[model samples]
Target chain A: MSLAASPAPAFTLYDYVLSGNCYKIRLAAALLGVPYDSIAVDFYPGFEHRSEAMLALNPAGTLPVMKTADGVVLTETNAMLAWLGLNHDPGGRWYPAADPVRGPRLVEAMSFGAGLTGSVGLARLHAMLDWPVDGAAARRAGKRDLRQLELRLTAMQIDGEDWLAGGTAPSMADLACFPYVALSPDAGLDHDGYPAIRSWLYRVRSLPGFVTMPGIHDLHELR
Target chain B: MSLAASPAPAFTLYDYVLSGNCYKIRLAAALLGVPYDSIAVDFYPGFEHRSEAMLALNPAGTLPVMKTADGVVLTETNAMLAWLGLNHDPGGRWYPAADPVRGPRLVEAMSFGAGLTGSVGLARLHAMLDWPVDGAAARRAGKRDLRQLELRLTAMQIDGEDWLAGGTAPSMADLACFPYVALSPDAGLDHDGYPAIRSWLYRVRSLPGFVTMPGIHDLHELR
Candidate 1:
């Protein structure tokens, strides 16, 4: 893995490795070539995210709380990705949307990311984290979401586009939707039907400086 | 209802009157004094939102689909709110706070809104729309979400702020999080514990050009 060049990145992310939300942040930082300290929060059995210190940091008790160098604390992983894309990337490469159009589309993807996280991601929790989710309901929802995503990707491909929001550049739209989707199998979602989405995942992994979690295979490392 | 001055807003919102997501668009447009044509999409037993036309508009089969003057279509309510705030409000009054901070905070609120929608909003659907949600679990999660909102609002109020994300003026974050929260009672969540959020909702209603849905009573009308 590529490391930060000079002084340590002033970002500190309170994270849980198994969390897709947390993974998005790590992915963004890795892609940006920025390094941040990761303090693992035991989200599964221990559920330390609800502890006093964690709640004091973010009352919502959500994982992947990020403390920027300026001491500004933020929860919501996609928001952190957005802040990093907007502030840290001087070239604005990660957020290549031209606005009014691409911007709203990115927002749409982020919102869908939320739905996918709740359904597919929640379904995964039942298996790996001992969290009991409504199996049938979550599976149904996850399948529906996959179809929707596949449909969008198919349309984008028809339009001769590869990325989700931006034209040629991969944006937060891609990152926000990636982890849980790549990990949807843990949720019992069959991947055989989503060819376009699978291809898109490969493209995301092949980006210049991509990273990976346990379930998300790093394309470079595999090859 | 205030209508837009001549040369109509080229916006078209496919909405359901009872939908909080749809109400968010009405609220934003009302607050902005921008008028749009509303095309009601029967979301209840009819489920026309999933019809071929609606699916063509938004493959996600979600409501509050918006067709902008530029013909760009959007489905997510909060994204529509953000798009309207970013584009329509030339003064940037609705998208307050500097980037890198307020932006992330707004995103956090939007994500929290998603949770609240699933919890409190889902509870309401069981009654109004005959949607069979997990009642006990939803109520429990709804109450927890309310408490979290209460805590955040209390902190923001103590910080001498009335709105959710911005310093003083109401922003899209407030609008995005407001509808379902104000209408939580329909979901069997008691309002007694969330005084700060309650007061904050009133402040939102008191804003100039504020609009209301069925359950969300207008403060001005009450007095």
Candidate 2:
């Protein structure tokens, strides 16, 4: 028999399964054990994300927008990640900014996610969608972002750490940055030169209850 | 008398006076009473942000990078806003995400900051910095963002909420969105069609410790 309980976790994800932003929410729920409904939008050539129905959900046309059973909708992927980490993670490994020691590093990692990581996603969009863009510059910027992550991860490994936030465990930092970096090859960019990041990608893939999308597989690129 | 026990707040902001991103940090420090040294970076004609010294500080070349006396550095503007909100705001007004009732609204606001408001900033960069870009697309996108904010805030006013996050007071959400919206005209856009956003801008300028950049004044567009 089902026990009488509190309010249900009613989540409806406005998902474009192939979109990394949408995949982020899916992965977050999988890792955190938050269950939800998924509404697949025609994001690619169909461009349903910009349709009137989608605009009613998120006026700016950004996606992975979600509506809680209670009617709270969120559009920014990183913001959604932060919310899941803060509100759901009992182990406190995902949203470690509450920890004084790990806080600053987490902020830095977040900065990287909000700004530098966008380049990689944009480049990927250009490569996959036939979207007109300066592919070379976007790839260059994406490469720079990868190298930056590689440099930091290299140092973390030397110090006996595995996560991006200088903590022993993964935080929203890793989750926010992982998908695009792993899928960078689809944008004609690769991390062959960055061994540390390759290993870190492997580690993310190894997270308990991890999920995957069309472009990237759940496999370790390095040992 | 100076405190003998605890360390002083030694914060230095690597600033570009004309940049709304850098202005964001300056505004935060001012509102919070966090004193900082302003190290003006020759961001414009000189392109010092790409210089070797600047690159050493932030490899991605984004500005408003701040260094605390204890040697902590921050590069992303929104990330820095979140940091200040979490660490320095004992008052709890500026960072309402800590409050459970307001948390979801704050997340929605954070979404706006990370994604939609970026169009205005990018448009501004194109207009003022002699940067070649798709001015039409950027301005179109930026206008759409402004209209979106206006619709929300207008409805909020009818509901008697003045702040972006539906709180009684300004939160990180308000501050994160204010600079770019108020500075929209520099990018060849305006709020003539968005009276609610104009009033909102006025309300922000009217904050107790509010400071002003070069273009936007400390006066209400409405009154």
Candidate 3:
């Protein structure tokens, strides 16, 4: 055997296949080339995430719970993104929490993404899985958030920036917001009026090592 | 004249006096000794935060809008806290996003704090300002969050850690969650049920350079 140090320990992601929040972690790992072992959890009909055992692991009863190699259990999806970026990304551009100008914007965009999970994400769940939520309120809030996102993207496009945090390269901020926005059609909200958001979504999907979920798919060329 | 350079530029904070979210920024600035100009906006009777000018600054029309020295407008409270910690704290401990273990936990705590704003914060608004919201739902949610917070603090105390992120010195995570949790009494959620949370709150209040808002007060020693 060759004399070499052991490979870094892979993260254990307690994930659900249909969860956009779970997809956020998978997409971040793929883009950053970080390795993780995903244990599929039945989130929909099974409601396994809310099971006693899962609640013991994460009191929040949320999907995409990440247990690090060091055994630190992270319940928030954005936290998982931050951990992946800070620990795995060699270029240090994915998180950029150190840069004064970009850091706050990054945090803002990530927070906005989390808000989208409440709005767009909830609406999508109501539509797709027949979840008992105020669908009308969720849709209204989703529309408002989508409009805000479009306006921000339009401003960025006008200012000659490509990503959410206005950095030359995409950061965790982009990944944080991408999944739900891309999956908005499931909520009966389309990108017809959001040209800027459409363009931005395309840009995110075009990134190297980009992955796809059940709702969001890769663009395929016609044979 | 001495050859010293000009002082760092001060940030402009669009604030509301009674807002726990706004107090978060004020408290962070005080703790970090970061100077900033506060522009008071009547969030309650005046509804000044939703005014057109404020909307122009932040489309979200959120209180605690922060205009940085470099002219970047930040609307999220947690973002402002991250900015203050990352840019102002010389010790590098307040926002330790570089440390993989602490970083994810910090993000998790911060997100939890944001959620408390929705639960505890909304409940407080409904109770104090008579905001048109489902007070019962808000209180129920707030109680659940407070219980979860108490459990987390209890676990941290068992681990011999004082702060939310389980760090020796308190990080931004503590500050992010402090305001809403401290102000939960305004929502009729008392600290009598949460001994660990009450102890943690006292510790945060006792920190050097601690500041207070309307509902929260300084522990004055009587003769």
Residue-level lDDT tens digits of model 3 in A1-223: 9888756757999999889999999999889887778899989789999999999999889888999888888889999999998889888889888787788789899999999999999999999988899999999999999999999999888889999877689999999999999999999999999999988988898898998988786866301
Chain B superposition TM-score per model: 0.93, 0.90, 0.95
Interface RMSD of structure candidate 1 (Å): 2.6
TM-score: which is higher, 1 or 3?
3
lDDT of 3 by residue, B18-45 (tens): 9989999999899888988889998879
- Model 3 ranges off by over 4 Å: A1-9, A221-223, B1-9, B221-223
Task: List, residue by residue over A1-223, the lDDT tens digit for candidate 1.
Answer: 8875676776999988889989999888888878788899998788899999998898778888999988888887777887888777888767643375677777778778867777888788876765766777777878888988998899899878888884787888899999999999887786788999989988988888787889877786647
Q: List ranges where model 1 is wrong by over 4 Å.
A: A1-6, A96-98, A220-223, B1-5, B96-98
Q: Of the candidates numbered 1 and 2, which has the greater TM-score value?
A: 1
By DockQ, who's the top model here? 3
lDDT tens per residue, model 1, B12-121: 99999998888989998988887689898888879999999998788778888999888878778877887887788888778642365567777778777766777888
- Interface RMSD against the true structure, candidate 3: 1.0
Point out the higher-scoring one by DockQ: 1 or 2: 1
The per-residue C-alpha lDDT of model 2 at residue A17 equals 75
Per-model TM-score, in order, reads 0.91, 0.89, 0.95
Q: Name every residue pair that clashes in candidate 1.
A: none
Native contacts recovered by model 1? 0.62
lDDT of 3 at B121: 98
